[model samples]
Target: MTTIKASCPSCGDVELTPHQVRLVVCSVKSWSYYAFICTTCHEEVRKPAGRDVVALLISGGVVAEPWNVPAEVLEEHEGPTLNYDDVLDFALWLEQADLLAAAAAAQGPRPRAQAPETAA
Candidate 1:
């Protein structure tokens, strides 16, 4: 597996994992590329759409400063607020719940016990 090292754009920490980063980078843009999702904070280190990156990072606990970064930089990592572990745990819980629901549905409604035939 390939390994890549980079800083968490949200936290300014230089330890983003390869898995945490995505490479859907902007080719023409002169700004830093190499997208990443913070594992500890789940802050999108790239453009996530909706709210600003700083806001999202603040909400997700990715960075300490909510207003330190540039406005444009802050306007990037926007998405649902969630840390990596939270995301994973929630996903697992949802998956288990769905499985249980599916199993219950497949079992269908409970059937009433049939009366035994009387001897003639």
Candidate 2:
């Protein structure tokens, strides 16, 4: 069994086995991280795992877990932030709005058919 060395904020240094370490490699590079429980304080410690650290841990028998975050979750939007009152207003409006009727109204009135010209 391999002994892995990790540091805890409260406990300083602690030893861990490969099984005791959790390595997560995220789809987003900066989100990759490793976590372990400190032996002395029994507190869970988590740290960012860069490429080099990830490779080292994997080489030492630690299994890497994959985290795939959706792109939409990270997108930037330009708009006014919605507040609780805005959400409540929309919910209230939804309850009374006739969605089907509104959709029909949006299409506007159909063009009137022209009467056939009377024969001379």
Say which candidate scores most in TM-score.
Answer: 2
**lDDT per residue (tens digit) for residues 1-120 in model 1:** 434444565666556434454443122233323456666677676643223433443344343211233457546566787889998999999999999999999989998999999999
lDDT of 2: 0.95
> Which pairs in model 1 have colliding backbones?
53-74
Give the per-residue Cα lDDT of candidate 2 at 43. Answer: 87
- The TM-score, computed over Cα atoms with residue i paired to residue i, of candidate 1 is 0.27
Over 1-120, each residue of candidate 2 has an lDDT whose tens digit, in order, gives: 899999999979899999999999999989999999888888899999999999999999999999999989899999999999999999988866878678889999999999999999
lDDT of each: 0.54, 0.95
The TM-scores, one per candidate, come to 0.27, 0.72
Residue 9 CA error for candidate 1 (Å)?
A: 4.8
How many clashing residue pairs appear in each of the predictions shown? 1, 0
